[model samples]
Target: MPPAHSTRPAIAFAVAAFGIGTFSLMDAAMKDLALAIGAYNAVLWRNGLGSLLTGVLFLGTRQRIPMLAVLKLHLWRSFIVALMAVSFFWSLTVLPLAEAIGLSFIAPVIALYLAAVLLGETIGREAIIASIAGLGGVAIILVGKFSGDYSDESLWGAAAVLFSAVVFAYNLILARQQAQQAGPIEIAFFQNLFTAAILALAAPWFFSMDATGEIPMIAAAAGLAIISLLLLSWAYARAEAQVLIPVEYTAFVWAALCGWAFFDEPVTLTTMAGTALIVGGSLVAARAKPKLVEHTEITTA
Candidate 1:
């Protein structure tokens, strides 16, 4: 008889997939909220609310506060998260949700290169090919956008999203380092606290009370983010990171569907073409043998 296969990894993969779906819904909520309020305000309030939820969990769980070293790492990661969130939310204001999401799919490819440079992983032929395809896909999308009647604002929005993707890649690298030192709950708590603190400086100028009715949406976004973070953390803890990485690509499909259903944004040919390359490239890069170094936990909270 064939040996019984372990169900643990399969269960973890399923949870991770569900987490990705929840994250997509959170993105849709944030896009709507960002359109209602300014991106800065939306980000500020979301992080603030997220901090509250995480703080409650942190306190209730009685996790030890991080040491100075861990706290420093947390702060830096939080700053990157703040930047990534603001840029992505800003991009959503001007870019169609599907197109923006398609462009952001280059992040895993970027992460592969970052892993090589920062973590000293070997960049194999597959990674090189994947990088080329991902970059070419991004170029095609950018050319299409610029060829049309794109406004300067739209150009800036595109730039912001691209920049966010780069930062997010680095954030993934940092997450690996972080996973060794802290639990997901502690990480989420400090991430929100630090993100809110960083954005608080601009809150006075960008804050708004007019969108009070949208508070539920903002809270829901926070809730979804926290849940996704916890689910991903749990999965990463149980299974190899390589096994879970493919689950990340499912976000593209969710984004495409949500963009159509919620915002009435049709998936264009350019988006379809670009997303194909990005997803194909990411899968190629993911095939590279992951180094035996610590597994990087993904968190968007």
Candidate 2:
């Protein structure tokens, strides 16, 4: 029989995939919300409310405040999160959700390399197979979606997504580290707090409630994001970055669904085919050898 820790990788991989799906659905809402408001406002309002929501939950957990080191981790990660959100959502304003997500798919690929370098995670055989399947899935989606369109603004948006993708790669590593150090509720709380704080610095200039009509939608967006973070944090705390990261590809499958339901973007055959590859890859990643040790909680002292 496998060791007790051996089962965690599959469970964590499943949880991480579910988290990505939830976040992708949130992205669809944010795209419209961002176009209605500004990207800055949409993201700012989401995080602002997320702070209150997570705060309430954190209090319910009765967890004490994290130490200074954990606080530093939250603050630093938030800076990257804030920037990544702004750029990616702003890109959504220019490109269709599917197209934007396709561009951002580069993140998982970049993150695989970062996982090895920053976190010293091994690029295991399962990880390599999963990545190939995921990238092939993304390539198929992009080919099916793009038509060699030529728009200056769209080109700029693509660039923004690519930049955000790189930052997101690093963000994944930080997430693994942070998850090891904090509970999901605590991570959710401070991440919402510090991310909002970072975005708030430009609030007087860029923020607005002019999109008040969408306040309910914004609140829902905040709820989805927080829930997703909680799930992902829980997963990362139990699994290696290599195991969890492959599941990020599953977001495209959810994104395609979002496009179909919300944006009238028809699901093409290629989408179905690509979605299959992503799911297959995720399963392979989940099948990773659980010989590795699971992450243990780091102490405050």
Candidate 3:
């Protein structure tokens, strides 16, 4: 086997782009599921089915069950992911897919600051400028929404996406930590398991068996999500985060096309303008190098 660093950046970027495309499709399917049944039920079924699929893969691979400490960390991440997924999917149910995706571009910028604060990484001038640009983009989008014939539902949807973006930023930081300790399969499996377990508590009130025909769609969403997560995890483990960050912006393009083709939601000028700024800022931030820290190693017997 080749060294981890031997993985070409081009290959990693390609994988990341493919992952984004799959995830964009998954999001579109999820939006459909949410509209057909309801956001809560959609989330419940998706996670439950995802857990089953990943669980089978986990066992087939003969991976050991995580210890209690690892399980606790997984549980914590699962909770955050659950909140992020629910909020983002709810926003999808109301907002245009491209608009919702454009707003989510704030997450990479937020992750820059989170890494600096939580991981002691140094922020550079480019990152500061990126943050300003990203925030400005968001302001522009919000102003456009307010000036338009926007309803309260749109405002709520925007708020939900923004909230999910914040949580997702933190989740990125946690992902780095988790990646150091476990493989992508383990992370994906436990994530679904824990999310399903948590969401199951609310299933009694919100769950409905009304949309059985949508099972295929829900399963497709879960399958795409799993593939995307695995691909991204593999890419990140092999390459620098900075190198892969720009690939994330490609989701906007995919989302825009998917929204137009599937929902007849035209990409508005506001979305284009805001997305350009956000993507530009993210690229700048990605170019900034984090300060390197030297580590002293100790051997444990």
Clash totals, every prediction? 0, 0, 0
TM-score of model 3 relative to the true fold?
0.84
lDDT of 3: 0.77
* Candidate 1 stretches greater than 4 Å from native: 1-17, 124-147, 235-248, 273-301
What digit string (tens of lDDT, one per residue) describes model 1 on residues 1-301?
Answer: 1222222655666788788889999899999999999788888888899999999999998777667888999999989988999999999999887678757767767776676687565666765776676667656655664565778888898899889988887887786567656778988889888999999988678778886888999899889988988777666555444445545666776788899999997766776776677567656644555433343323223
lDDT value for model 2: 0.87
Find the 10 residues in a row with the least total lDDT in model 1.
292-301
All candidates: TM-score: 0.81, 0.95, 0.84
How far is 167's C-alpha from truth in model 2 (Å)?
A: 0.7
Ranking by TM-score: 2, 3, 1
Clashing pairs in 2: none
Residue pairs whose backbone atoms clash in candidate 1: none
lDDT (tens digit, per residue) of candidate 2 on 1-301? 1123333677778788789989998999899998999899999889999999999998887777778888899999999999999999999998888878878878888898898898887799988898899889888887887767669999999999999999999999999999888778899999999989999999889978696889899998999999899999999888888888888888887888898899988888988888789789889988887555455554453
Provide the lDDT at 300 for model 3. 22
**Residue 229 shift from truth in candidate 2, angstroms:** 0.4
Full-model lDDT, candidate 1? 0.75
Worst 10 residues of 3 by lDDT: 292-301
RMSD to the true structure for each prediction, in A, is 5.6, 2.9, 4.0
Write candidate 3's Cα lDDT for 44-79 as tens digits. Answer: 889899999999998999777766776887899999
